[model samples]
Target: MDVSCAFATALDSADNIALAERLGYHRAWVYDTPQQSPDVWMTLALAAERTERIGLGPGVLVPSLRHPMVNAAATATLAALAPGRVAVAFGTGFTGRRAMGYGPIRWSFMESYLRAFRGLLRGDVVEWEGARMRMLHPAGHAPPRPVEVPILVGALGPKGNKVARELGDGLFATLRPPAFMTEHSWVAYLEWGTVLDEGEDTHSEHAREAAGPGWALSLHGAYEFGGPEAVRTLAGGKEWLGVIERSRKQRRHLAVHSGHCVELNAADEAAWYAGGSGTLCEVTLSGTREAIRRKLDDYRARGVTEVVYQPCGPDVQRELERFLEVAKSDES
Candidate 1:
C-alpha cells in the first residue's frame, strides 16, 4: 500500500510538504477549512513550487464554498504548477460549511456540481445554478483546459459512496475503506493518531494533543450525521454532548467543530481529558508502531490503496518523520 501525508494547513506548511517529498509520501493532502486554515489552493500552490514529485491537492473540498468554475480554474492552475502531480477530491461540506453556520451539502447538489465542475475542466460550457458558465482564461493565462487530473470523492456514507462510484476516479474516506470497495478501486483512507511509545498511555498529554483534534472529529461527525443522539453512543459521548450544548457560541453548530483537525478547543480538550482516551484506539488509527503497521496491512486487505495519515499537535515534523519511518517498515 502507498503511504501519503495530510496537513492541517498552517502558515509555512510548505516546508512540511517539502519534507514529505523527501520522506517519500506518495501524495500530500491539505484540509479545506478556510475559517480554520489557509486557503487550500494557495497552500497547495506553495507546496507545488517547493516540491517536485509528491502529489498535492486538497483531500476534500466542500462543493458549496465556491462556484464550479472557480474550483475548475483552481484545479487547472494547480496542475500547471505541479504538472501530472495534481489530484483533488470533493465532498459535501463538513467543517468547510459548518464552521460558517451552514449545514453539510446534499448529494444531489454535489452530483450536479461535480458534473458542472468536470465539464468546466474539460473546457465545456456547462449550466451551474441558473446560468451556463465555463473557464474563460485566455491563452497564456492558465494551464490549458482539458487539464486531466484524477478527482476523488470523499465520503463516509452510502449516498456519498454511490456518487463517488458513479462520478469519481477514486474514493477518499475516513476510518475504514468501505466493505464494497475492491483492491482495483483507487481508495485513499484518511486516518489520525500517533505511533505511541511502548506501553504509553493513549490519553497522555502528548497523545491528547496529537490525537485529540481527530478524536473530536468523531464527535463532530456523529453530531453532523446522526445528531446529538448519535454522539451519545460513543465513548465519553454524553459529556461531549454537554460540552456542545453549553458552548458559549449562540450557534452550537459552529462550536461543534471549533478545533477541527488543527487543535483541540476547550470543549474538545475537556472531553478527551475527562475520559476520551479510552476509545482513542477504537475510533482512530492511533497506536504503537506495530499496531499501526497491522492496521496498514488490514487496510490493504480491505481494498485501501493508500493511507493518508494526518498528524496533529505542535510537533508536526516529529510526527511526520516517525510516521514515515514506520510506514516504510513494510518495505524492509
Candidate 2:
C-alpha cells in the first residue's frame, strides 16, 4: 500500500511536507481543524510550492465552514501547483465544529454539500445558495479545465459511507475499514504511528504518549456519537467509566482538540496500553518491521489502498523520521 503523512497542521507544515517527500512518503494530508490549525488551503498551497513529487491536500475539509465554490477555487489553486498530484476530502465537521461549541453538520446538508462540491470540482455548473455558479478563472492562468481532482469523504458510520459512495471518488477513514467497499473507491486508512523496534516495554510509555491524540479522539467518538455502550468496549472504559460519564455530563466533547483532550486520566492511558481500541496494536503499526509489513498486508487484503500515518507528540520530526526509516529499511 502507498504511505502518506497526516500532519497536525502547524506553521512548519510545509517544511514537514517537503521532508516527507524527500523521505519517499506518497502524500501529505493537512488536517482542517482550524481551531487548532492554520488555514488548510494556505498550508496546502505552501506545501504544493515547496514539494514536487508528493501529493498535497486537506485530509478532510468541513463543508459547513466555507462555501463549496470557495473550496473548489482553493483546490484549483493547489491543483495548479501540483496538477494530478492533488486530491481533497470532505467531512461533516467534527473537531472543527465542536471546538466552536457546535455540532456536526446534518447528514442531509453534508450530502448536498458533497454533491455540489464534487460537481464544482468536476467543472460542472452547480447550484449555490440561490443561484447556479461555476468556476470562472482567467484565461491561461486557470488550472486545467475539468481538473480530475479525486474527491474523498471522511466517514465512520453507514450513512456517512453511503453518502461517500454516492458522491466521492473514494473514502478517508481512521483505523477501521468500511463494512462494504466498492471496487472503485480508494480507502485511505489513517493510523497513529509505525514503531517496530523492540524495547524493554512492548507498549512503551513513549509509544502510548505518541498515540494519545488518537486515543483521546476515540474517547470523544465513543462517548459523544458512539454512545456509552461503545465507550464500554474501549481500553479503559470499564475502569474509567466515571470519568467518561463526568465528561459526558459536562458536555466535554466540545473540547476535543489538543491542549485539552491530552489531559486524560492516568487509568485511561493504562487501559489503552493494555489492549483495546486506540492501543498500539489496534491503532498503530507496532512490532518488528516484518510484522508491521504483514499487518499492512492484511489491510491490503481488506481493501486499504493508502495508509496515512499521523505522527503524534512533541517531537514530530523525530517520530516521522523513525517511521520512514523503518518503512524504507523494509523496502530495501
Best-performing candidate as measured by lDDT:
1
Per-residue alpha-carbon lDDT of candidate 1 for residues 1-332, written as tens digits (9 for 90 to 100): 88998988888679899988998889999988899898989999999999989999898999888888888888999999999999899977777888888877889999999999889889898997789887889987788788898999987778888889888999998854577667237988899888889989988888888887787888887887788899878777788778788866568877787778878877676668668778888778889999888987888888888889898888888888888888899557
**Which candidate comes out best when scored by TM-score?**
1
Where does candidate 1 have its weakest 10-residue lDDT segment? 175-184
Model 2 over residues 100-209: C-alpha lDDT tens digits?
A: 76878888998988788778777788897889998788766557567678888888788888888888888898746666554434988877754646652445667666
Error of 1 at 86 (Å): 0.3
Clashes per candidate, residues 3 or more apart or on different chains: 0, 0
**Candidate 2 stretches greater than 4 Å from native:** 238-251, 259-278, 328-332
The global C-alpha lDDT for each of the candidates, from Candidate 1 onward, is 0.85, 0.74
